[model samples]
Target: MNRKNFLSSLLTIGAAGPVLAAAATPNAVPSVSRNTAASSAALPTPLIIPPYLRPGDVIGITCPAGDITAKEILPATQLIESWGFRIKVGETVGKKDGVFGGTDDERAADFQQMLNDPELSAILCARGGYGAVHIIDRLDFSPLANRPKWIIGFSDVTVLLCHLHTNGNWASIHSKMCNSFPDDWAKAEAIQVECILSIRRALSGERMEYKVPPNVRNRNGRAEAALIGGNLKTIESLAGTRSDIDTAGKILFVEDTGEYLYSIDRMFWHLQRTGKLDRLAGLVVGGFKVKPDDPGEEFGQTVTDIVTARVKGYGYPVCFDFPVGHQKDNYALKYGIPHLLDVQEGAVTLTDTSVPAAATPSL
Candidate 1:
C-alpha cells in the first residue's frame, strides 16, 4: 500500500478515533494520543520476573532479525545452560540466506513456535539485525499475551518491544541482546546475567533504582512519563506505522550509531515536522556515537547540537550522555513504564508499579 493509504487505513482502526500526531514528514516518527497520567495510580512497583528457570525450564532462542550459525548459538546457549535453563533453539535460529537469518516465513515460524511453547520461561533473541520487521506482522501474539515471558533484547529488538507494548501492552525488557556477548565478552555475559536477574526481580515485585545523570538542557523540573525510544533510526522508521508510539509527556530516550551528524539532523528535523519532538515531555540522548568518515565531510554537526536545535522549541527537559544506546553497560529500561524526570536536581526515577503489582504477579 502507498504510505498515504497505508497510514489512512491505520488511523481508522476503531471507535476510539485514530490518533495521528505528526502529518508533514512521512519519514519522521508518527504520533499517537497518550492517556493521562494517574498520579495516584501508584506507579510501577518493580516488574515480576518469570519464575526462576530450573535445570529443565527452556530458554527459547530465535533469530527473528539476523541469521546465526551454530557458532553463534553454541556459546550463547552454553551460557544459558550454565544458568541452569535448557536451551530451546528455534527452527529459524540458523536459517540464513544472506544477511538475514532466514526467510520471513522461517523467521516468523521460529518466533511462533517459541511464543506458543508453554514450557519456555523466557525467549531470547540470538541477534538483532533487520529481519524482525519481516516477521513482526506474520506472527500472532495471542499465545504470548496468555503466557508473557521475559522477551529481551536491544537495538532492532526495540521494534518488537514497541509493538508488544503498543499492541498487547506487554511490559518487556530493553537490555542487551545475545549478540552483545561474544566469546571474549564473558564479563559482558555476566553483566547480562545481572540484567536478567533484575528483569526477574522486576517481574517478581522487586524494584530497581537508576542514577539519572546531570543534564545541560534539563527541562522538566518535576515531570515523569513512560520511557521510550531506542536506535534513533529504527524509532524514526516506525513513524506512521502501528508500531509508532505517542511521546507526549513521556521521557523520550534517543541514541544512534554509525550515522553521520547530518543524517542525524535530518532525522531530528523529520521528527520535528512530524511533531514527535514538540509534543514530547522531555528529551534524553543516549551515547550518540558519531564517527566521521576519512577526509571528513565536516557537516559541522554533533548529535547533541542537532538534537538541541530540533527540541529547543519544545522547552521540555533534555538530558545527554545518558549511558544507553550502542555502548557497554547500557542502562536498562521498561518501555511504556511510567517514569519521573526531574531536571533541576538532575534525576529521573521510574515508578515501581505503573501496572499494579497484583495485575502482573510474580511469574
Candidate 2:
C-alpha cells in the first residue's frame, strides 16, 4: 500500500481507541493517554528514574533485531568492561536464525531475561535491523516498569523504546549499540570517538546540554517538554499501534538514513495529518544521511525544506542537523524525560531538565 493509505489504515485503528486500560500493578509504569497533551497539567507528575549504572554494575547485551556475530561486539563489550562494569552476552548473540540473531522466540526470551535480571543495571542492544518490531509487543515490560534500568539503542530499537514509553511510562536511551563501537579510536574517525564518549557519558548519568550548531531552517523559539522520537521510519512504523507515541506538547526528535527524499517528506506529512506535529513543544531534525532522489524524478526540496514546510507556522523551536541517527556522531538522548530546547541568536541548546539537581552522582 502507498504511504497515504497505510497511514490512513493506522489512523482508523487508533480511532477505535485503546481496547483495554493499561493494567495497574505494583512496579508497573502508568500508561498515559495517547491524545493527552504534554503540559504539566495533562501529564502525570511522577517521573520514573531508572537506576543509573555505577562502577562494577552489570550490563546485559542482547540482539533483539538483527543477526550479529560475537566478533562485531567484542570491542564495545571490552570497552564497557574496562569502564568497571561487567558484561553479560545473551544466549541469542552469534546464534543465527536466518537473517535474525535467532528465532523471534529466542530474541524475545533473551531480552526478557535481561529485563527481569536485577543484577543487570542496563541492557545494551547488539544492533538494530528489522526484526525488533516482530518481538517488541511480545516482551513483558511490566516486570521492569518500576524497577527500571536503561534500554539502549536506536534504529529498530525505537519500537521497544516507544512501546515502553507509551504503555509503561519507562524512560529509555537512544544511542549506539555494540556494532557501532570501534575497538581502536586511533584508527577511527573523530565522530566515532565522539559516539563512544556520548555512550560513556549517558551510562554515567551525566545530564548533557547541547549547543546545536545553527540551521537556517530552524525556527527561532524556545520551549521545555519531554523528549520523544527516534528513527523516522521506526516512528512511522509504530503509528496506529499501541506503541505510537503521544507527542502533544513534547519535543520530538527525528532522523533517518538511506531513504528517498520524497519518503521522508511523506512521513512528515503523515505526522502533520495525524496531528503529531500540531501539538509539539519543539521539533528536532537530526542527521539525514545519504538521502537520494530518484534518477529521473526529483523531490525539489531538501529534508530541511520539507520539515520547515510541514511545521511552518507551529512556531515551536525546530533545530535541524542535530546529530542523532545512523551516523557516527549519533549522541545519546534520554526519551520520556523533560528537556529544554532553546533556539535563539545563531545557536540552539538542549538541556536535560528531567533529573533533579541533587539527584545522582556524576562520573
Candidate 3:
C-alpha cells in the first residue's frame, strides 16, 4: 500500500473503533508483572550478560533447527575464524532426520553439550527453518545459567531467545545465521557483508546503534527500555507458554516472512488482546515479506494500517521498517539488553544503552 492510502486507512480505522473491537477475541490470560519477585519471573535482578568472545575463544556451531550440510556452513566458519575466534563444529551439523537437524534426542544432546562446554564462549545456530520448539522442553538450561554465553540466530531460533529470557534471564543475539554467510566474501554485496559482520561486532561486545530513514507513518517519540522481540508469528504461537516473552515496559520489535496481511493483523490482535501491546515502551516493525493476496480476497490493509489500529490508544513510539528480520539488512540485536529508541522526523535511532558510549564503534 502507498503512503497516502495507508495514512487514510489509519484515520478511517481510528474513527471506527467499534468495528475492530467487535472483531477482537477477549484476552484469555491474566496479565502478570514481568518484574514479579517470583524466582521464575521473566526479568530477574541483574540480567545475565553472557561473557563476550575474546581472541581464541571457541564458538560452537550447532544445528538446533533445520539440517545444514557441512559444506554449507564452511563460509560462516571461515568468516568467524578470521575474526580471531575458534570454531567447534557440533555433531548436529550435517546430521538430518526429515526436516530437523537430527532426531529430537540427538539435537537436544548436542545442544546440551555445547551449553556445558567450558571452552566455548558462544553458540551459533547453523540456520533457522523449524524444530527448536520440539527440543526446547527436552534440553536442560541450568548449565547455561551457571555459565552464560551468547545464543545466536533468528526465525525458529526465536524459541531459544525467548526461552532464555523468560526462564533464565540470560541475554542472547538475534541476527543472521550460517546459511546467510556469503560464499565469496570479496564479492559479496556491502550490505550482506555488513549484516554478517554485525554478528562479530555483537559477540565482541561493541555497543550497537542502528539508524534508518524516517517513515511518514512513524510515531514520533523516544524510549529507553530493554529491547525484546523476534519473529511475530513465533511470538504469538508462544503465548501462555514458558517461553512466552514479557513485553511490559520494554521495546518490542517484530518481523516475519511470507504471511498474508490478514494473518499479520490476527497476530497483532493476539498481541493486543493479551496485553502485550498495552504497556510497551515502544514498538518497531521490521522486514515483513508479505504474500500477495488471492483474487477477490485482498485484505486491503497495509502493515502500517494494521499496526496503527492495534496500538491506537497507546502512546508509545512506533517505527516501521527498522531493518531487522528475514532479510539481508537484518542487524544484530541483543535481546534482554536495555536500548534507547528515538523516532524523529528525519531518522530513527536504536542505541544500545547497556554499554558505555565510548565502547560503541562508529557505524
Which candidate wins on TM-score? 3
Tens-digit lDDT track for model 2 on 267-337?
99999998899878888999997566768888788888898889885767788889889988888888777
Which residue ranges in model 3 land beyond 4 Å of their true spot? Answer: 1-42
- Against the reference, the lDDT scores of all candidates come to 0.63, 0.77, 0.81
TM-score of 2: 0.87
- Across 1-363, the per-residue lDDT of candidate 3 in tens digits comes to 111111111111111121111111111111222322211323433465666778998999999989999999999998898999999999999999999999988998899899889788799999999999988877666555335568999999999899877764567999999999989888898998898888889898898999989999999988877788999999998999777998887889999999999999999999999989888888999999999999999999999999999998988889999989999899999887878889999999999877789987846
Q: For candidate 1, lDDT tens digit of each residue in 102-123?
A: 8877887888888889878678
Candidate 3: residue 184 lDDT (0-100): 89
> If both were scored by TM-score, which would come out higher, candidate 2 or candidate 3?
3
Q: Specify the poorest-scoring 10-residue window by lDDT in model 1.
A: 5-14
Clashes of 1: 20
TM-score of each: 0.76, 0.87, 0.88
Q: What is the TM-score (0 to 1) of candidate 1?
A: 0.76
Error of 1 at 80 (Å): 3.5
Regions of model 1 farther than 4 Å from truth: 1-57, 82-84, 185-205, 293-296, 345-363
Give the per-residue Cα lDDT of candidate 2 at 349: 87
Off by over 4 Å in 2: 1-41, 356-363
